[model samples]
Target: MAETVSHHLGKGRLVAVEGSLQISKSEKDGRTYTNPQVIANEVRFLDWPKDSKKGNGQSAGYDDDNFDVPF
Candidate 1:
């Protein structure tokens, strides 16, 4: 199963995180440096509401708002 990460939909707290982190690297004069690389990252969900519409999670077979029936 694919890993999932979920943050607090309210107070913006971390709920879960599953993934590998990769740090950035730089090359200069055939040398590499990794001091200023990213150490960690956090995923958060803020825009999505806490309660979403209940349905089959599928798009309706109607375009009532998108367009009219092309007869």
Candidate 2:
């Protein structure tokens, strides 16, 4: 299912997704754990950024260099 969505979304597209949450419990090694899951129901594509080609011909929001700043 995710593969199909990824294919439709393509490489550089953005989407607003809607989904439902599922909660489950499991016991492992005498310990109980709660897990939450997201089940995707709908996805709406958003417009591409205007400065998509500013950096390296990729979207400005997706530039790898944006995360290179030193703290």
Candidate 3:
């Protein structure tokens, strides 16, 4: 099963996600991100968690993951 979400992004708007995802800027916006290449830029896997109960025995809850960016 897969989940999909929609959001509004502005000029220089940025988002980051873990694991694999598809990312794109809507045609309505001048900024355009397309296909696998665009997906590649935004998806990252966080460091494996110390706890062993989640996500292929890898990642834990979001709080345990590092968000190094200042936003």
Candidate closest to the true structure, highest lDDT: 2
Report the C-alpha lDDT of model 1 over 1-71, residue by residue, as the tens digit. 11332221346432333335566788999999875432224443323333435353322332224312221
Checking candidate 2 for backbone clashes, the offending pairs are none
| lDDT (10s digit) by residue, model 2, range 1-71 | 56545544566667766878899999999999999997777655454444555645455434444322111
Best-fitting candidate, scored by TM-score: 2
Q: Please give the CA lDDT of all the candidate structures.
A: 0.37, 0.58, 0.38
14 in model 2: Cα distance from truth in Å? 6.7
Shift in Å, residue 21, candidate 2: 0.3
**Candidate 2 to truth, TM:** 0.44
**Model 1 regions more than 4 Å off:** 1-14, 27-49, 55-71
List model 3 lDDT by residue over 1-71, tens digit each: 11211222223434455444655545546666564523322333344334446647443333446423221
Q: Which residues of candidate 3, in runs, are more than 4 Å off?
A: 1-5, 21-71
Candidate number that wins on lDDT, 2 or 3: 2
